[model samples]
Target: MNHHAPLSPAAELHANVSVPFERAFAMPKSVYTSPEFLALEQSHVFAQDWLCAGRAESLPDPGDYLTMEIAGEPVVVLRDRDGAIRAMSNVCRHRMSTLLQGRGKVRAITCPYHAWTYNLDGSLRGAPAMTLNEGFCKEALGLPAIRCAVWQGWIMVTLNPEAPAPAEALAEVTDLIAPFDMTGYRETFRESFRWATNWKVLAENFMESYHLPMCHAGTIGGASKLEEMVCPTGGAGFNYHWILKNDSVPLALAHPSNTTLEGDDRRKTWLLAIYPSLLITLTPGYFWYLSLTPDGPGHVQVLFGGGMSEDWLADPAAEAHLASVRALLDDVNVEDKGCTEKVYRGLCSGLAQPGPLSHLERPNFEFAQYLARRIPA
Candidate 1:
């Protein structure tokens, strides 16, 4: 755990990940800057884990769908005719073309190449002009199915067919977040952006609020008091903490219907990181999340969404409130982008060695531990 330790693959990893929370150091810069390590994570970590897509509520109707890339594998996530959500390979069975591009609705997923069509359930329905090929059996050809499920209203797809259900791994906190009514929050805004940093960097940043008072001093961070924060113990798949806010701030105010929380919960903001890359922040009046995907060791794509609670959504000032919230969040994001990108540049400088973790950075310690176990030895 020494900061000045000589750098090697194993030594670098050990330097960052092998230490107690109080004496912990940041993961080596190589962990974020090495393409070799990114490839390893793609295979052993992302490919084997259940990754969150957007909310299932986004696709309320049958045949509605969204597509995302998981560990370099393109996947189609959709609700079929029977209202069952399914994840299947986006690669068409014929000619290997991407069947769906992005989020949309369709009676059937039809390939832009060669006109191969598939039913909502991923069954091959037609293969035009394939009669000439006697070996081509339409019934036998279909989009390969991937493991998928809707848990707590979020759509999650795993590239590994044998992975356990996402809900099962997340059970430790199911009751903990029940008060937030995760399913009742409808997405009112969405933004997709890329950060010039590793996905883990962004994930670690979002999991803890240690830098809030400084990084976001002018916005929501102004209300964050470090002394009042409560960090939950790490579990198999998640880490969370609650930061109590000043009651006078408009941003810290509670929703009218948020009666489930009492005392400190009334003014507390909850931040939860669900395993590898799903980060959620819940307040009494609103909730937002970041679902991150890595494009490379130094590039991360983010799917960001936020929404109001049922109480606020019913208010006459909902739109105005939402606009203000969005603006505040945008400012916070800009600040974060600058901070993380700069850190990435520093890490790439070769002089950036592992640094000691703060008491507030316990979540980062847990995250490093999680990554260490899954990364190739």
Candidate 2:
């Protein structure tokens, strides 16, 4: 008898990541379940790319801020005294304590451990006992800064200084999304949940509509015909698709603010998956996004938020209208969560392999190509 070592599932799936769209197979189970691959994605894919932290509207006033992590490095995104948005390492310069846990309006970022304080601009403002140390100049110490950009009201940060600006990278996407007037939309709701799936799995899942008729049957899936979905081949930065809604349907069938949009644009929905981790869905009346972050090989954290267009927010029955929309969105999310969780479980069972890709899953194909180009074989 002879003994042989088995090939790792992740190694087996590496070839599928770059297969042509028409001939592409589903992502390999190892891609979702391997710690090694997850580590690579964190370093090469996320750390080097722009990531969405949250909506700028959430931090309306100076000193308002939010905290998030990229490639496992903690970061704080805030508006400084001069009202400019900035991003800096959340780790305290003195003892490495995380400066902030969540969102709040703060006059200055002060470490909970030693009360070492930093100005809104990230300059060191106070150090409790550091004056006693020789040559410890507060002027010379501040939280390490990361590149930050505000694009269409979303706060974006990148660990790599040389990466493309968010505005420049999203210039085409901005034009495609401009008619909806996202800058005028006010973020009204936010919710977060942890999923037992790889970040890429969730990203690919949200980017496709082929599963809608089956997976979201009871909520938004049945409202549109399968034949009406059209996915556009996007360029380097992102990919999108249109799902035309029936005029008689209840949700987003007829938005009062859609008067400015032309025939199909007014009646359909745009689903865009920005490279790396931002997933956006824009309709005539409202838009929502998910900023995805990987926790580890086995989990991902999703920061989900949405807004109503200024016009829709001004309707006399806005409260009741939002209530209905929220209910539908909540249900639809539950459906997605259930499906992705099941897929992850199946991938972990050691019997998973790549399956044929559907024409409707073109965005997933492009995303696979994006990852293949970045991650080493």
Candidate 3:
């Protein structure tokens, strides 16, 4: 008898999705509905890849910290005493209690359960009434460290120590948009919320601009010309598209004093979908991004943030521009939330099936392939 193992449902779906762009179809509905599929992604993709936590600038001072979960593992990214950003387990070494909650400045990582304190560097500093235990050693009992690096100003953390550095993996992206000086853009605001949809559904939504005219009709739709949207084949770690338009928001275009980006380049907006789950909308005068994590098969956790470039920040009308940008983004987000949730609802129906791909959804096609390559059959 032949010893061939049958392909998994995910692998079969992947095989169907891995065709040429012209013949490509949307990812099957099971990808968004199956708990098993989500588990595979959690282990093979989220756990193995460099996941963006937030902007490094947000954790500038020593003891500043932000907490997030990766594939169910609690991780805290913080600036240590030496002003170096690092990541470590958010679980306390004693009693296995969570070390921190949300984001804030802390002198030490202390577990509220028993007051087992760890320094900002994750080294165990104090554990009350532990001297009686003969096996206890504070030096060896510090919180476990996770691999972390800053790439283009974003703080990235990984559970796999052997994974490639963010810079090395995103080298092509770095060169592709170098003139923008993405690292120089400051984050003005960030908010975390849950969405009623699969993480991939939201990721695909961000990867394509095909739905702007219909889904975002009330907000930015009038300004979004589908004819101007260009979707090219994606790179190994990311996919990107371009929208060249005279922006409705003045600050969205390049500043008069700025000379780096010339001509139409000043009005260009890059929709970048970094592999697994970081989505960025980078413009000459401003930038915004969404970092996504799966809450379950039916829900996703989102870190939404955006801000202005240094030149725009220095402009006399900066405050008004920022307020306008924030208002527009908030409205856009409301539109997206409704659309994505409806998609998720449809995926739950037995009648739902993968449809043909749009030329503008090339990035989504590439994203399906990426998922196929990562999750085992």
Candidate 4:
């Protein structure tokens, strides 16, 4: 009997830099395992680069405030009485107590630690014990503001109070999905789940389709072929676009005012990944928004939300479809996270070293390279 080749559960590491351009793409596994690297990313990457925080629809009017943590720094986003959305440090200027405990709306944030109050706009408004500190100046003690920008109805905040507008960096990403009426779509359902793998592993997993037929068979196997998907990397290694097949016939109606698209343009499904973190997927008439946020080196939280036009929200059946989509996708994500976490554990083992990247996993390789190049050599 002829002997069969032994099977291996592994991927090839790319060493050639030729055909894909001069820069051979690769990211070291340590980028995810080093504490110093994570801190630098917080101050340099997450703090300086735009981090998508909340949705525009959430800030409906003045006094509406939402709180979230950015690179471990707590921040509060709110629309002031002037109707302007602003991101402010959640830390009260006085006594250093955090201004907002969690997410919600409030007329004004009053620190429970000392009863110091701040206007929704982040200005110091009142102090019950102003006389207690003769030198305390309310104007000088106002909460500091952060750089805030909005694109495609999503809010992005940067900690560098004077960082340049993210419009230029995020503009192209916005236009890529402009054909769809996104703002008209509200995040009818929202969720956050913890993944057991390195953030980069999850990111890499998302950046390519090589494993779709193998890894996603349970969820995306029906009308999709991983071989048919596309990954064209550009934008300083920070942006990449790819397509996926969807089984649903409802999302095919996305032909907008471009006018050329008609009722017949529904044969294929397209998915685009806006680098660093954002996946815009189209299925039938449904638009899915997937956000990948890093919690720690091997721990990440996936944010799943968005889809449907406001008109769809008005329909009673909308909730059912949204719920169904979330449930299906959520199940698939759980499976992926478990697999990636195992990969991370293997990487830390002294028994093995890093390997190659397949031509099919180019997107994944490109992502690893991007991370490698960004961190200090």
Best by lDDT: 3
Per-prediction count of colliding residue pairs? Answer: 0, 0, 0, 12
Candidate 2: minimum summed lDDT over ten consecutive residues — where? 248-257
Considering lDDT, which of the candidate structures 2 and 4 is the better prediction for this target? 2
* Candidate 3: residue pairs that collide: none
In candidate 1, what are the lDDT values of residues 259-291, reduced to their tens digit? 677877777778989988999888777888999
Residue-level lDDT of model 2, residues 192-251, one tens digit each, is 899888788789888999999899989878777768778889878788888887654333
Cα lDDT of model 4 by residue, 1-377, tens digit: 64775321111122222235334444545566666667766765666666766577767888888777778888988888888888989997777888776457888899989889988777788988677877988788788888887776778787876655666765665565554545666765666677777677777766666766767777765555656656665554255545544446333344232353344333344465555666666543566666766787778877767666655556666677667767777777776776788888886777756556666566666654454444444
What would the TM-scores of all predictions be? Answer: 0.95, 0.95, 0.97, 0.84
Worst 10 residues of 1 by lDDT: 247-256
Q: What is the C-alpha lDDT profile of model 3 across 1-377, one tens digit per residue?
A: 76687656697677877678899888888788889888999999999999999899999899999999999999999999999999999998888988789999988877999999999888899999999999998899988999999999999999998988989999989988998978999999999999999998999999999999999898878776988888887798999998885658887799888999987788888889999999999998889999999998999999999998999999999989999889999999999999999999999998888889989999988888888888866
Supply candidate 4's per-residue lDDT for 287: 64
* Regions of model 4 farther than 4 Å from truth: 1-26, 161-164, 244-246, 252-270, 282-284, 310-316
Task: Find the candidate with the highest TM-score and give its number.
Answer: 3
